[model samples]
Target: MKNIDVKSFGAVLLALTTSHCLAGEPADAGEGTVFRSLFGDTLERDYGITVSGLVDAGFSRNNNSSQRDRNSGQTNAPVAGLADENFELATMHLFIDKALKTNFVPRVTPLPGPAPSEASFGFTLEAAYGRNAQQARTYGWDMHLGINSPGDDNPDKARRDKQNFLAIPNFAGTAYLPYAGGFTVMAGVFGSGLGYEIPPNIRAARNPFASRSYAFMTESGAVSGVLLGKRLISNDSMLLGAELGVIQGQGNLRDNNDSKAVLGALRWRTPDMQTWIDYEFLVGDSQNDSTGDIQTPRGRLISRDGQFKQQHSLNGWHRFDQKWSIGGEMVYGHQEGDGKASTIDIVTGPGFDQAHWWGANMVLTYQQRKNLSLSVRAEHFDDPDGYVLFPSSTARGAFNAVTAGVRYDVNKYLTLRPELRYDWFDGQDSARPFGAGDARNQLTGTIEALVYF
Candidate 1:
């Protein structure tokens, strides 16, 4: 008798499930001479696991003295908040995953329906590092512990932590169950079901801009939760999901507050797969787990817990023709309390007001050639209460931005994108958000390269 390892066993099981055994063998070939002859080397072969990754790096130059703080060399610029004119590693991600089988048999048939499909189970582990990782990392621990500083005037080198160096953004397992038609269950940190623009890693992720919108920045990110989804129609065009999780904004494994969040989403796609839409709603606490010491509306920063937050978003994209496509997103988000009162701690009592913001953006893309594409985006966000944007400033107004870019695929593994963007601060009486406090608008030019396996 011989002992078998997990990888070798996995390969054997896959071959058996796929009915890919050697040909010219008896149906009941327990004495399998041909199988042994053809796959004698299979016992040493790697299983179905796959390895893929992406490298996103770029140089960005700003026009308004770069708006970078002279003392800290940090800018409040939008997406690629690089130091004025410098090259930066925007983001890098490595993924190890396996495709799960898609057929599952029901334990017990409760109703008459289509035949059960085979069951599949798979997992994904992904790690990311770079500036984008800094932006997407969980906010509370990273910010409070000084692990990351997005717009800090003075950064502490010693306190800079591993959250920005090597962050495990996603580790999820997926399983399929043949219940009513079928159900897919995912556990662990998963990308937000909202947003038309996903984290840019590969071409298939569908993020056309190097700079992101204000809505995308504030609405959602990788969430630590359990998600269950099912197809509601036979065409496989409609999907509905329910998510229960630790709350939004924070991506760490632990929940910050006693309050939990519930999220619901609906996704629809056309039969041709050219048009798709997704809507998601979430309500939960946005505060951290601070038990003591919070800020108030008063000039002094004190100790007080914060209230719950609510957010909803709709994102969709449509292909008008072979060469043209359009995408749009709308987001509405609100948090309870003013700047000082919005503590990271959980608050059960109501002593604050609601700060809200709503924003929408439209994206147009044209495939000029097989390897060349162009995209333009226009977005507007209104923060009348100065809630979601500049919390400390007395500014209350809207922000608008326009962006145009082109993507040129040099090859299957490499792409180059160059873009120009302009942002305007509308109806603000105080400090400007983009520049060095003296300007209301800023202009920037950026180019990035994405290399993937």
Candidate 2:
């Protein structure tokens, strides 16, 4: 796993970003963003507060949209927040951070370098609204779907986002101690650091295509826990870091059950910061039943159905030249004691003791020009029992996605992204998951405008 990838999301992210191919945007900030220069960098360099955000709006056309499905409010469907057929506001995002100062010598890469000569404290806050907030919602908040419901049939579920589901993906504080290497401790609700793509954000640095991968679609978006990160080894050519945390079960605002879980991550990168890899995992009973009553996505609390699971992944990226790069990720998950979910109730008995799924994808990018880049991604996901993607369908086997996209920098504070993608399934025939369950495959075309401020 160490020999394969660069990376995305999770613990070490409070640190600066490594130079990835999708990296030159205002989000990277070092190349310079509106907010970074708004106060002439004084906000970060003097007051220590940095602000950044964007407004994302787009239109999508799906080849599978039918009159019947459109009337029912389901189209190419729930693959992210992009499950709609016309013009829509995807999200309005805001990020504010007071960076912690570490005692290590700063490198030339990664922008907005904080004062690294001393040990200090800092905090981060993020708020997002629009269709994308649906997935960012916690199990016991924002949303209301539960385990025993037939399915999510809210009617309003697919068309647009209401004002009620606003999400704060991160509200955490950290302290950096200039000790052996460096010790950073953080607490509060933070974004999940386990995948190659950031949670629920189509604008994530790893997802230049503006569309998510199957590997990132259904993982928990946030966890109310504490994370500890440390730089173990730092040198001119290479660096290593580690993190550990304890938290409430996945997507819970408060205690949904009596048990908590443990998660840890390890990362290694080069000083040049062009190549890196990450490995991380979470182990615990994120469900109800043994510890307490089960709480559904809708905040409905009921008796447990024996839900215990594990989610793990390994991902990374590498730059081969000024204009070429590649990145890849492998994801695996296991669930035990989970009852089959249905409209009526959670089913338990024989033939439902455990479920497992795994998937992988590779991304290749070419900097066609200084202001325009092209990317192609190929991925496959398998879930025989539909554990993670339960609400999508019950069909099993291998699911695949192919995507090609273009990123044109209209300017420093704006980008235009146009993408085309195809998704299909093989194996089970009992259910159809796309085009509102009427098609085995779907093709979608989308173009978005991201205006940074």
Candidate 3:
């Protein structure tokens, strides 16, 4: 008999527990409740804390695979986020949330009335056995650009080399203020405010798609920072926020440089809350070194130093009645002085100091029934410096893809999505991104199941 790996086993157990907790069913009293009731002692255990989680798994096949055993390693999808072709566990997320009592005003009150404000604390512990988990682990605490570690030099690859499960991406504390018609302050590691797509399990309703767009595929993941937000207009029609952080992205255990990143955002919505728009901008330094698996984009291992990175993005969505809606995103990002060995020649070229990339995506969804919805997405991405794409080869170019899928609610606790996607490459060299220089276009089919508890 083969001995089982203990860590993998533990991850599986955690996943199951999370799924059971978030499955959309009523919480059971269970033996603990019975014991407490029998003793007539309610430990005040259920106070203000909430626990929830999800288990996401998928079965996918990539026609571009090089062999049955090895991946093609040339697709646009980031490493671990999506495999070339396989049945995999995408993510298992467990969330714990607690709201601080708002009525506990101090004996010496500064305000005339009760402090009707509350504070909240929440954290998500994520685990994965597949490629996506391998790509999303943040290393160190708030590390910056241009530092190197000995053993696993490639930050992104290091994840592939290390554990098969476990990631803690969201650890945050939020405070609500009653001043100026109420506002919020939050600090910790959280998702970036720049992108339309986010890591799964953050929202009550999961996005109806299996894969993500190029913008999400290549953009920053999370940030270690502090943020402030407040609604400005009546009916919550307008909101503003700002973020100050250690750097632009995640994965580093410590700050590698002295500089930091700043971000600002403005959001507007209709009085009916049917249509909304957000504009966000971020400026900061991005590390050229490999920090870890969590911060890298598309599994590209960056090895330069003191690279300046900036981003501008706009995102919005509109609801046309309750059955149909549309959303879109546009983003442009640039980086310079962040190249490695292969980019030296290019960076030294005349009038070339930076690499630029831009992309746009649109998503349309239709609700077919109470438990069913359909969605389609199309996007185009451009990369001129080959910075975020083909980090090894000089594959500066563009990529285009489209996806169509359906979301079916099997039950309150289970959801399934089946999708089809196609991608085409327009690199300088025959689009030789996949292995053996033979992959320029790809067709993939995938089905994903999500269990919430």
Candidate 4:
């Protein structure tokens, strides 16, 4: 496994170097753009287009987990275990953007599949038009239109078997209007400006964290709404901001329902440092069907059916310097629903009325140099329901994990990252009847290479 990992990393490094060297020299380039003339007029202008992208690939191995079998597939310990080797081409993106003037510009980013297991490797364009007289005054509108085709060959099964092309057409916009009292009003659908780190979907794109473990409370699509208010105090030394929004419901596909979601957040930053604190709250009737099935964009499943869940989270991050940082987040969720017999009366459950889950994550990182760094993250989850239908044997459970990795910058355009992850699971004795006991542990190591353009 170690030999394979080294060979794979070396190959990716070679490819990235070759591509970077080629990119430095354009074919038959002799001040090409500046010399071009159109209709006796110089075509050269200060404005230009910029394009960039990245490709990441690597191999990983698992230790205590079940081996790869042709029938049961690969199992990587539900909570934490090692199983097999894997590789991925993380992201391949092309961005075309132009700055028309000091205040106006247009941009578009089209990306294809980043990994081989993806359904289809085709471009999905996200285009936008914007105007920004200054950072304090800016407005932008964007639209997305694409067709995603399924890669699976099965054509008969209805739920997870068939393969088809899905069309996506979504519109969203945003405006940041600043006022005299260090305040601003922001409004948009699917717009940016909700929090510090990017959401899970946008971060991973193709393979987002969708299982019950992450994102305790799930929403069907992007949050679409209007946010009001802004930073009460603003300066290089201190900052505070608050926002509220009324968004579309979680499972409403048509965007025509009267049900809605209300969200609020408060953020604070210390002066003269990269340290911040954020508190967020979400409440609403996020469920649609009364049946025990929850509808998601990918499909429908029965888990926390007909349950109303509320989530509260607090997060903090501190950057000691350019070379080191630490961050952590704590999240709590509570669900109210009809219990087994009670849900039977409402035709929704066989559920737990007062189900709840909570977890926390901590991360530490050190940048040894411009081209190398090391990071470690530890996380825990406590889910009373083992993602099963009501009255299952798995009553309550807890999972804990620690991941450590080192990243090396092969060059300006390429980077290699190797990581090791360990996980531990604790649950009822009857929860798992297989060879594994109530407590299980596993390990995984992955080496990834990224090439940026």
RMSD of each: 11.4, 9.1, 7.4, 11.3
Model 3 error, position 207 (Å) = 3.4
lDDT, candidate 1, 1-453, per-residue tens: 011243653454345433523443333322222234565524324555656567676667766663334222335354333432455555667776665544221110012234258667777677776656644544333333343443322234411321234456667888777667667667777665566666754666667877778787665566667766655543444323333334343354455555567666766666565776777777766554454422121101112354567888888889999899999999998776554534321222333456788999999999999889999999998888665543323357888999999998765545788899888888656757665556778788887767654
In candidate 4, stretches whose alpha carbon ends up further than 4 angstroms from where it belongs are 1-17, 22-52, 64-67, 70-74, 77-85, 89-171, 180-221, 250-258, 290-294, 297-307, 340-352, 387-395, 432-439
For 1-453, candidate 2 gives per-residue lDDT tens digits of 101111321112212233332555434323335465455788767878878776665677888886555444336564554655565556668889887666331111121223255678888878876556656665554444342122223525444322223677778887877666567877888776777876533344777876788888655668778888777677676777778888886777667657788877878787777898888788776454432444554222133543567889888989999999999899998876533442112432333556689999999999988889999999999987655665445567778999999998755555788999998888665667777666778888998767665
lDDT of 4 at 275: 80
Which numbered prediction scores highest in lDDT against the true structure?
2
TM-score of each: 0.75, 0.81, 0.75, 0.64
Instruction: Report the Cα lDDT for candidate 3.
Output: 0.56
Per-residue lDDT of 77 in model 1 = 52
Worst window of 10 by summed lDDT in candidate 4: 129-138
lDDT (10s digit) by residue, model 3, range 1-453? 012354674466455445435554344422122233354443336554455556676667766665632333224243223453454556666665554333211100011224455444433333333335444545564222122232124544433332234455556675666676555565676656566776763323325688777677565555667766655554343323333344434443345444567766666666565776777777777643443432333223344445677787888888998799998889898776533453232233323356778999899999999789999988887876666543433456887888999998665556778999887778875556543456777777888777665
Badly placed stretches (over 4 Å) of model 2 are 1-45, 71-74, 103-117, 139-164, 200-204, 290-294, 297-306, 338-351
How many clashes in each candidate? 12, 9, 14, 6
* Better-scoring candidate (lDDT), 1 or 2: 2
Model 4: what TM-score? Answer: 0.64
Question: Cα deviation of 426 in candidate 3 (Å)?
Answer: 1.6
Candidate 2 local Cα displacement, residue 97, angstroms: 0.9
